[model samples]
Target chain A: MISLFLDTSSKKLVVILVKDKEIIGKKELESINDHSSYLVPFIKELLDLNNIKTNDINKIFVVNGPGSFTGTRIGVTVGKVLAFSNNIPVIPVSSLKQYIFSLENYDYYVSIIKDKNNRMYYGIYDKDYNDIVVDKYQTKDVFLKDINDLKNVVFISEEEIDGIDTIKPILNINKLIDYYKDKEINAHYLKPNYLKKIDAEDKL
Target chain B: MNEYKLTTRCEEDTISIAENLEAEKFPGMVICLNGELGSGKTVFTKGFAAALGISETITSPTFNIIKEYLNGEMPLYHMDIYRLEDNPESTGLLDYFDKDGVVIIEWANMIEDYLPEERLDVYFKVIEEDKRIIKFIPHGQKYEELCEDAL
Candidate 1:
């Protein structure tokens, strides 16, 4: 079975094609401004590079986000369209969850994405992969105040925050596919995971 | 909302007012400047950036949309929202406010709905040649104190 993983929730764009337990073709680039333009072409390039056809993709792993509003939409939309058209199982992975997917040794892991002024999408996961602290959009101040009381907490994020030494998350498509294989949703039900409400969405 | 008024007899007076505000500057300070063209809006911004020790020639960000000066005492995110009035994309704009920088938005009234609840607004009114009436309306407690100290 062939698995395709796509993450475009931030400045970094990741496209990985995994065959069985091994990752075959992976492309990670900083396609800063335009995610929509780069996503499909990169998918096609990875498939062509691996000598696989579009119909060979059996499953799709898409990072739905509490991230850049436009970037999140582009990724989720593409994932939905591909899954629907090709009859593949699409799994919606949390961008925050992806930050700590590989850090199971730690008793606790804190994943945060700074979304706006002093506001962030924060989640805490236990060694069992349970969301000990339910994912929510809140001020960094609130998270810091609560974290002061915890022990052996590892912070994972894309940006290096002050005072808190953060571990940069490395996306491993093979590991991610193996872990979230059963968490599949119908493509029609997939939507951008915006933890906070957007101004335009409110108007609609 | 707290409001104050000031009159600048010349461009130097406007510069001094900006300098006084700079004295009270802090990280994440949001200042909104509004006025007609050549109404000393750019003059005030140049004065503020100069006071922040930004030596690079300050040009209006009208064409660039947003100009970032990171070498200053604190980062200065100079933005022109006039062109972005009709644009619906505002994803990364609010992120600058948390960069621990002073965000100065020109033609700020264009996106008043998106502005932070805590900010200072400066309105420039042309009264006569070489003279301008500047009105300061501050929101939130910190901005109210900023006007009390600077205006």
Candidate 2:
């Protein structure tokens, strides 16, 4: 069985391919504003480099948002199209959950993604990767206040957050594939999890 | 007594400032917005709401007086005190200061006497069809640091 995972939830574009539970090829690109233009071609290049045909991919896994709105949409849309065209199963994974999957060793882990301003998208998880606090946006002050009483917490973040024991989390593809082997959803129902409303729609 | 001035070229710029300011938000934080009509006060509020993980559409509270959004990272108590010029006390507006939520008051100048001492005041001035000059006045130490961090 072959599975492909794609994540465009941040400034980085991550693509991973696995065949029969073994790692094959993975690509991570620093794509800031060019996700719409570079995503499909990048995916093709990743597959061609590994000599893996598109038909060989039996399932698709994608990080569906709480990050950059456009970036998340681009990856989700691409995954849905590829899955629907090939009649393959699609799995929508939370970028926050993926961060937790990267930190299974910690007894308590807090995953954070900085949003515009001092606000952040955060989630708290246990060693089993079960979410203790679901993903939400809050100011760094409020987030700290909420976690002030918790003991032995490790913070996983892309950037440095002051006054916290922070570590840069590495997303392990093998662990992720093993963890969510049965959580595939239909391609027709896949949607980006924006977690907030767009500015244009906020008017009276 | 610290003041910060920002010139925004468009609505997006105004919202960007608001979103940035939202990152430093804390419970019982009060933001006082003073601006003329169509001066992007609601735009700033909308940006702040979005940063707080609010999914519902945040409209101006002109008719409602005060609108509460409890689904965000923290509750957001939005107030448009334009109609409260004559009867500010009737609405129990000051009670929100201790609600453990972020409070944003539009046309806040009208209720000057009811405002807390340690609030951040933003005044918007229209420069062009799309341009705005916003001034941030921090009334306390926390707000002053917030201005420094956000600007």
Candidate 3:
């Protein structure tokens, strides 16, 4: 099945077009909050480069939240609208989960995204793919203490720290190809997996 | 889509309305307003002044690009970008955003190039003869909470 993945949760905007387990097209752009302008055009560019059309796409994956509020909304809104219009299944992928999945050979991993409210969007998971989060968001003090108490904890995110071994950012296409290829993963159930509420005027 | 529409109407003049609304704000907020040229942008500033508890008179700093009113509850940075040109390379009048106070920029469309990724984008336009429409959109979680509380 042809699958398309779009992630705009952070500073980097990632777009991947995958045909089953293999990647056919990919595009990346850097902008503060230019998601609305680039989203549809990036999709079109990817499709054109791969000689593929929207009609050939069977599934779309979108990163839901815990990142830029505007970026998350733009990506999800586009994904939802396109999926609904095309009658395709959409897989919601969490930016944090994708970050964790990027690490290689790490048993225990901690993922963090800055919430900018003196707190963090953080969680814990192991190679077994189980969450160890008692809370999705924790204050800086609490998060630091929890990290200090834990052993074999590798931080998987874009942020770098001295005590914690940092993992590079990983795209959802790479994770999907490595982990979900040939696996029985549900498409409709795929969601952003956010621990904290996204702040936006609509939500208010 | 539930089709939710919320309109905040005040019987008082623009200054009083803005002041009442300003009094209900929190830090790290994004405010979007929609009104016409003479529809009370400056009058709204007076309300913001009252909300910030500023004793000074609020005026339109149209030519100055932005003005700071810091002697209040929270720092109030008011801006008027009407004189700004709509060129992406110009960066417009975004230098006002880096301050510590709640930033309010008039004529946002003039500097769309430099708008924060997470901010409140207010659209101000005139509706009827004397009515003004102010549409507020909070881009991030911080602003969302502020909007919720303000509502």
Candidate 4:
């Protein structure tokens, strides 16, 4: 069975195809702000180069972001369209958790996606992949206020933050798919996991 | 105390002033522009971008709200906050100040609260067709120095 991965949450346009939890094809391009135009073409390219037909894919793993407003929505829309049309189950993954799965160090792991106006979308998890605290979206000042002194808390992210130390994430797709394989839901129920509320949330 | 005023008779005069400012461009420079419609805000931006060695046709980012030009000699982040007033929760607006690029905002008065402290604010007053009275207010020492030489 074929499983496709789609993530455009941050600056990158990431697409990976996994067969039986092993990555067979992937495209990870950095600093692609124009995800809407590049996403579909890259998906086709990934499948064509791998000699895998889209019909063969049984399920899809999509990162519904806590990242860029437009970039995340484009990825989510494509994933939803593919799932609903193909009648396949879609797994909605968090953009923050994608960073979390990249590390196994420390008792607690923090995955953060920094946004506009000194704000961030952060997820904190224990080693068991259980939430230590619910995911949040707030200014960096308010979020990092009391957590800076914790020794066991490790910050994991791909992007650099001012004055804050961060370790780069190495995404383990096999572990990711293994964790969310059975958590698939109907395409209609799928939505972008934007932790923060925006003015156009009710409209868009 | 760091304010300067100039009167321009035509579009060329405005373009010259923009190019003069662009000649002294540095990373992380924020230029706040305010004026009524047709007061040469976008025209000034185009001149500045052109002087910065961007070949692309520069246009107002009213619809896009914010547009980034990375192909230029320096990264140029252009924004128009006219329509953004309706949606005040627009995220990441101030983060551009630290991006090591030249950020020019049109209709900048709309987001006066979010404007950085170390920046240049230019207000345009239309005197007549093809004529404008421009006022430059430099906030901080860096911008004060910039205006002393460029304006």
Candidate 5:
């Protein structure tokens, strides 16, 4: 079975194709802010380069973000469209947790994706792989109030990778593929686990 | 009030030096980048962002006051205080400083009081064509350690 992953959360467009725990093909264009103009063609090119027809792809994985709101929407929309058309299942992974999978070994990881409203998509994961949201996606005050003393917190994100005294925000897409493969889980709708609350409240 | 001097070729080179320094510096630390306009302050910031693994484009936050990049392995908060000339005591800008991330401030000289006393202060001065004199000063123990590491 073959799987295709698309990560268009920020300035970069990351696309990867995997088969049986190996990366068959991959392409990354850094700082491509024009998501709408470039994403579709990038995917088409990836499929063509691999010589794999869209129908040949068994599953599709996409990093549903807590990232550039527009970028997240475009990437997810494309992933959904492709999956639906090809009759393939879609695995919507959190762009933030994708950071956790990226950083291989650490006692604990604190992943912070960008929140344009001046906040972050923050979470924690222990060495045991048990994840915890210290402060769910919220702005600066909430993040600071929740995490007062920074001890054993390895903040990870794709942006501002230098500021945190902890780990880097490099997302490892291969680990994610291997994870799903071992679990025998084919493509599924893995929604983005963003902790952000939409301002619009439901009917009272 | 304290100072350490170093030579750099260009703006990006300044960032590379800052990046290497930040890689070994302490967290929960506040480092200020102070310089005159066009003195390569923002360029140095780009290098620091690169060190943090931020692959996104880095530019001066002169108008925005703060721009955070999370595209790499760490969180980088880029702040420009040039706009603070209007109101140094404004609440929103100060609040930005209170966020959780590594912050690099341009025109830090404009809003001195808004900054933490215990911070890293980098001073940039243009010497001649394509030459800059950069100084790193640590305010407290943490910043001092940062200065040592940056050295």
Candidate 6:
């Protein structure tokens, strides 16, 4: 069985192709404000490079936000369209979860994505990647205070944070697929998890 | 008053400072913001609001003068005094100082006379598109401690 992975929640666009638990091909592109224009073509190229056609993909996995609004939408939309058209199962993964899955063995894991104005999209997971803390937007100070006394904790983020032991996360597609194997949802129900409300939706 | 200066190379640094400030937020706390347009006054307020547990989107209350958000850990009084340059005195505005909420006033220099004597004043200077020089002036011991805790 062939599986496809797409991640466009950040400035980076990452695509991965896996055949029976083995990664056949992977491609990453770092571009700002250009996800919509490049995502489809990139995915097509990645599939072509691996000698796999779109119809051969049995399942699709996508990082469904807590990052850029437009980027998340573009990735999710592509994933949904591809999955629905091919009648394949699609798994929507959280960017924070992906970050945690990419980490090594640790007692406690904190994954963060810096949003506008110092607010962070953060998640805390246990050794088995279970949620010890829920995903939400918080100031760096509040987040630090929450985890300040924690023992054997490791932090993963794309940006350098002060007063904490932090490292950049290395995304692992195979781990993500293995972790979310049975949690596939209908493509229609898949939506971006933007913890922070957009400006247009603020006035309710 | 004791003054502290910090130069931020990007918006993330400014937000980190704001988040640290939010960790030390208290009732009746007043933060006066002074900076030119696009100097990140609203960005600082957004960081503070998120720390207070506000999930709602925060925008500059430029047209409304004062927008109150009570959904957070404590009430947040976000005010933009830019439009009040000519007439800074409004009776309702005085009520906010003692509302037992965290009040952050942007373009606060316009309404200097009406401000409390004991407050934290922050002045932002745009050094580059993403760089900023932020000056913190703490007028009281409590505010000084707040600066120490946050910065």
Q: Which DockQ values do the candidates obtain, in the order shown? A: 0.14, 0.03, 0.04, 0.21, 0.03, 0.03
**Prediction RMSDs, each to the true structure:** 7.4, 13.0, 14.4, 4.8, 11.8, 14.9
Q: Give the alpha carbon lDDT tens digit for every residue of A58-176 in model 2.
A: 88999997776667888999999999998989998888778666554567878888654456788887778877888876667777876877776788888888777678877877778
lDDT, model 2: 0.82
What's model 3's lDDT at A138? Answer: 55
Backbone collisions counted per model = 0, 3, 14, 2, 22, 0
When sorted by DockQ, best at the front, the candidate numbers are: 4, 1, 3, 2, 6, 5
Tell me candidate 3's TM-score on chain B.
0.76
- Over the stretch A156-202, how does candidate 3's per-residue lDDT look in tens digits? 65766545566766654666545543442344444444444333431
Off by over 4 Å in 1: A197-204, B1-31, B36-122, B129-151
Writing each residue's lDDT as its tens digit, candidate 1 over A1-204 gives 899898988778888888988889888887355678889999999998889988789999998886767778888999999999999999998888886767768878898876544667878887766788777776676768657776778998777777888888776566667778999999999888766643343234
Q: Interface RMSD in Å per candidate, to 1 decimal?
A: 4.9, 15.7, 11.8, 5.6, 10.9, 16.1
Q: What is the TM-score of chain A alone in each candidate?
A: 0.90, 0.89, 0.80, 0.87, 0.78, 0.91
lDDT by residue for model 4 over B49-86, one digit each (tens)?
Answer: 99998998999899988999999889999999987855
Q: Which 10 consecutive positions of candidate 4 chain A have the poorest summed lDDT? A: A195-204
lDDT of 3 by residue, B1-151 (tens): 0111234354245555466457666654445444567766676777777767899887887887667777899888787778755453233233234334677777766656456667766555566656666656777766665556654
Positional deviation of B83 in candidate 4, in angstroms? 4.4
TM-score of each: 0.66, 0.58, 0.54, 0.79, 0.50, 0.57
lDDT of 2 at A123: 84
Leading candidate by DockQ: 4
Query: Model 1 clash tally?
Result: 0
Off by over 4 Å in 3: A161-165, A177-204, B1-151
Over B1-151, each residue of candidate 1 has an lDDT whose tens digit, in order, gives 6679899999999999999999999988999999999999889989999999999988999988889998889889999887775443444675566557899999998887668878999999999999999999998889999888887
Better of 2 and 3 by lDDT: 2
Model 6 reproduces a share of the real contacts of: 0.00
